[model samples]
Target: MEIRAIDHIELFVEDAEEPAAHLRDGFGFALAGRGGAGTGLRGCESVLLRQGGITLLLTAATSADHRAAEYVRQHGDGVGVIGLLVDDAQAAFAEAVERGAVPVAPPETVGPDGARVVFASVEGFGDVEHRFVSRENRAGPFAPFIEETGCGRGGGGLLKTVDHFAICVPAGTLDATVHHYREVFGLSQTFEERIVVGGQAMDSKVVQSASERFTLTVIEPDTSRDPGQIDAFLAAHDGAGVQHVAFLTDDITTAVRTGGERGVRFLSTPESYYDMLTPRLGQVGVPVDELRELNILADRDHAGVMLQIFTESRHPRGTLFYELIDRRGARTFGSNNIQALYEAVARQQAARPAGLD
Candidate 1:
């Protein structure tokens, strides 16, 4: 199966307009489109914003009975859908369904421009859902209802398009979820590791297509080690779901520093983590002081080095966060940074009880 890069990330927000404004004003995205109707999507509204080929769909439920509302109620304002672009939508949907994927929406023709879109979802590593979207350009502003607008802002100040999403699942479900990606989506494991640092551990698997696109990193804590954020997310979210989204950047140091100055809080890595960076990633180009000051982390695999950092969860529900990644030639997730972030989040969670008024 040849899966392209991420098609789009759909989010269920408490107020679609608010987050949409934040993305537009804060991150510099253009409003790609908008949608809603008296049909099955009654009392609901959706806004699409785009920047660097990444579409952030923000949606909200206007009615109490709306599914969006129900999702927010269940998971808080978090990721509701992950759309993947495939060469063949029908074929992908059929393949997934044949392999036990639940059909959320059958292939249907929508829009006056005669575009055909087929979407179906399956249970992902957690409460997360995979939505496969197939499109053939037969559309009006991407969809029938969405009217295109000059919504994209921050054109010169944005990062590159979305690369892929890194999702955290329940502990012990790592292997099974990896199998789910392999069998259901015909994806193959690209990377695998059990990362341990600061006495924290997590098992992760990266799944991708033969084409090298459409990658997703599935992470689960190692129960044998100790309880951590993954366990807390599992308990709070009630199942598997997207944990954080990684935004790829050409220059990670600048990105992290800018994001930090702009009020984006990244999980801090222990100063000791840097003490061993020279030994672990001696060949990495960035300086250790730069990495420490920018709060970016560097790690290496046999292939090359990668830099990454996690943003603090901004959602009130403690779900859905962002990651800034600069993959210098490495195609793998920052395994070494996993435990750093896990411990960082654990400390934050621990202090929350005391910080709350």
Candidate 2:
């Protein structure tokens, strides 16, 4: 399977209007469109939002019986569906089924304008779902629901577009999930690492197709030390769910500065970590002084180098968040950044009030 880039991500939310406004006012995403039909979906609406090439579909259930409503009730507010763009939706569906991917829906087509879209989903890790989409005619907005409004000018220097997302799976399932992708989508596991951070450990693997657009990093934390967040996510979600969405930018310093100006909270790397930079980079090409000033973390394997930083989760659900990454020529996630992020997040978690009824 030659999977293309990510098409879009659908989030099952409690109230679309409020969150949509947050994205608009806070992150600069515009309302692209909406959707609902007479098929018991009259009240339910899907809001389309875009930043550069990335698209987010936020759907809210108006009635109790709506499937979106059920998803919210069972999993709280989190990512429910991830759409993967493929050259042929029908062929992708057929291949997945033949490779033992459980079918969530048969290939379905709906057309309003001269354009047409064929989509089908297969069960993915945890309670989440993956939809395969093939668009034809390329008319109207994404799907029939959205109204197709522009997302407006960039705010806080948002970069080129949304790139890819990183999701966490259960511990010990890394290899198994990698195999699943290989058998079902013909994806190849291009990178692997066991990252140790702040006395915590996580195993990760990257799977990609020929086009490079369809890249996904799967992570699973070592559970023996403590009931790590990855395990908690799996337990709560009843399987694997999206952990974080990574946004790409040509220049991360501008994006960070702009996002910070707009009040987007980014995780902080300790000042102490900078002391080791002189020995770590040695004669590496990146300007160490510049990296230190920006607080961007870098590391390299045989393939190449990657720079990455994470933003704090803004949602009350504590499930979905963002990653601002600059890949350069590297295909691997920055391992040096892992421990820094883990410690920062642990501090945030510790500050929150504990105990809930």
Candidate 3:
């Protein structure tokens, strides 16, 4: 499959309003389009929000029989569809299906203003789907099936595009998941890491497309170690699902500040991590104290250095959250930062009062 960048991501929620408002009123996203009963979409209501190169489709079920409702009931409010931009949707779907991917939806073509687009879907992790999208004649934010609503962006511009995704699977399913991406989408497993955070251990492997436009960090917990965040996620989410979506930003300092000022809660990095930075890696792109103040973690590879920080999951079940990443000529996702993130999450889990929302 000749994959380009991520076209969009569809999140199934109990109601489209709250998440849509969060992305709009808190994060800077403009309501681009919509589809519902009036738009000829039955049993579901969808709101498309856009910010820079990121398009998020928030869909809610209007009826009990809708798939979105069933997904929400099983996995809670989470990602169900990951749309990939490809040169040919039909070819991509056919190739994937032929390569052991279970077919979800066959290629369906739709055009508006004489421009054509073809959409197809295949099975992904658990109940999530991999939607192949091809804009043969022209490219647009959404398909022609949806009408533009002209809902303007509220206030967010600090963040830009999706950086990568951290996918948490069951302890034994990590290898199988990585193999599936390799066999179906032609993504290659690039790097691997085993991190032990506060006595809990997890192994991670990264898979990237040929163009490096799409990346999936597949992680699984070590059952012999302490039951930690990944375990907590599986218990709450009911199955494998997207753990966190990392949004790429040009200025992570500004992005972190904007998010913090807007009531977005992020994990805290210990001062010791910053104190040892100069001795370990020497001076990097961003100052150590500044990063520590913002609770942003830094790491470097042969390519370059990068800055990143994660927000605490706001979902009631603690299953979904976001990360802000700024890569400065850095092709590799921060390895040290992953350890830091694990510790950060561990601290959060320890401090959360039981029975609290």
Top candidate, metric TM-score: 3
Candidate 3 lDDT (Cα, 0 to 1):
0.85
Give a tens-digit lDDT track for model 2, residues 239-337.
677888787877776776676776777777788777786687564455777667766777765666667778777665556777887767776677666
In candidate 2, which residue ranges exceed 4 Å CA deviation? Answer: 37-43, 138-140, 150-157, 235-238, 282-294, 301-304
lDDT order of candidates, best first? Answer: 3, 2, 1
Q: Which candidate has the top score in lDDT?
A: 3
lDDT of 3 by residue, 5-119 (tens): 8888999999899889888766767889988988877899999988877889999999999989999999889999999989999999999999999999999988765567889
Cα error, candidate 3, residue 227 (Å) = 1.6
Error of 3 at 307 (Å): 0.2
Kindly state the number of residue pairs that clash in model 1.
Answer: 15
Off by over 4 Å in 3: 150-156
- Every candidate's lDDT: 0.74, 0.74, 0.85
Q: Specify the poorest-scoring 10-residue window by lDDT in model 2.
A: 150-159
How far does residue 230 in candidate 1 sit from its true spot (Å)?
1.2
lDDT for 60 (candidate 1): 94
